[model samples]
Target: MITGIEHIAVLAKDSKALTDWYVKLFGFEIVYDNGKGTYFVKAADGSMLEIIACSGDCRPTEPKEWGIRHFALSVTEDGFDEMVEKLKVEKVEVVTDVAVSPKGIKTFFFRDIEGNIFHLIFRPTPL
Candidate 1:
């Protein structure tokens, strides 16, 4: 049987900065800092996102591009609104305004320090 997703790895020009950005924005804690361009960040639900430092130009995916578009981080309804406000105050680039899908999933997208797009979603009710 297939197990759940363990983690998602992303290559970054500056792993430390990317790790710090997740920690600051989403409360992810640094579980491992190899000091050699590798960082393991753990979220509250035990999901991990690995940030690997690399030497190359950072190219983030954009809308209509192939490959992965973006990954979502589920949040509470209240949290969703609060986060949007916080991002605005922080001057973080908001790629899209808050919108609700046909399925009633509310979400908004934003860019990280490295221009990686992340969707903040709130599912008020079960699908």
Candidate 2:
């Protein structure tokens, strides 16, 4: 039987700094650190993110490259405003302005410290 997603992988030019960024911004717990740039960070709900280091030889892929487009993280309805302000203060690159779907789901798109795109969502109803 298939279980929930174990984790999603993301490449980073600076793995350590990206790991620190996740910890500082989302309070993600470090699951593993090789002390040589690779790290696994887990969110509050056990969702894990694998942060892999890319060296000088790494070729950057376009945003719409054949794999996963972006990772979406959910924010509580009450914290949605606070999170938006936080992103503004951090000077994060906004990929798209906040918008509401027909289902009334509010969402914002932004890029992470390592230039990976992410979606910030506020769902009125839990899935």
Candidate 3:
């Protein structure tokens, strides 16, 4: 049977830069690096992301690309505001201000170093 997501993947023109960015900002540790421009970084909670460099002369994805638009990470309700402020202090580019969903979830959008979007969310109840 199907389970939850194992990992999310993104293409990078510079694997080392992207990997280091995740490690420095999100505290994700490098699980594996192929030494040929492919890396797997794992979060403290066990979630993983594959950061790979595409072959020859590839470019970063545009913000308005037609694929998966953004990835999300959740924070505890108590720590939500703190995390938001932390991102601001780190100078992450904010795409959207906090918005409340009908489900009472609050989320804000920001961009990673490579312009990939991320959502920081806080929910009143876990689904």
Q: What lDDT tens digits, residue by residue, belong to model 2 across residues 1-127?
A: 9789989988898989999999988889999999888899999999999999986765544577997778999898888878888887889888887898899899988888878889889999988
* Per-residue lDDT of candidate 3, residues 6-123 (tens digit): 7998888777998998898777899999999899999877989999886776654556888788999877788778878888988999999788889889998998877788988888
Clashing pairs in 3: none
Ranking by lDDT: 2, 1, 3
lDDT of 1: 0.86
Model 1, 98-127: lDDT tens digits are 999887789889887887888899997865
- lDDT of model 3 at residue 73? 89
Q: How much does candidate 3 score in TM-score?
A: 0.85
**Which regions of candidate 2 fall more than 4 Å away from where they truly are?**
56-63
Residue 13 alpha-carbon offset, candidate 3, angstroms: 1.9
Candidate 3 stretches greater than 4 Å from native: 56-65
Rank list by TM-score = 1, 2, 3
1 or 3, which is superior by TM-score?
A: 1
Error of 1 at 32 (Å): 1.3
What local distance difference test score does each model get? 0.86, 0.87, 0.85
Q: Which is the better candidate, 2 or 3, if ranked by TM-score?
A: 2
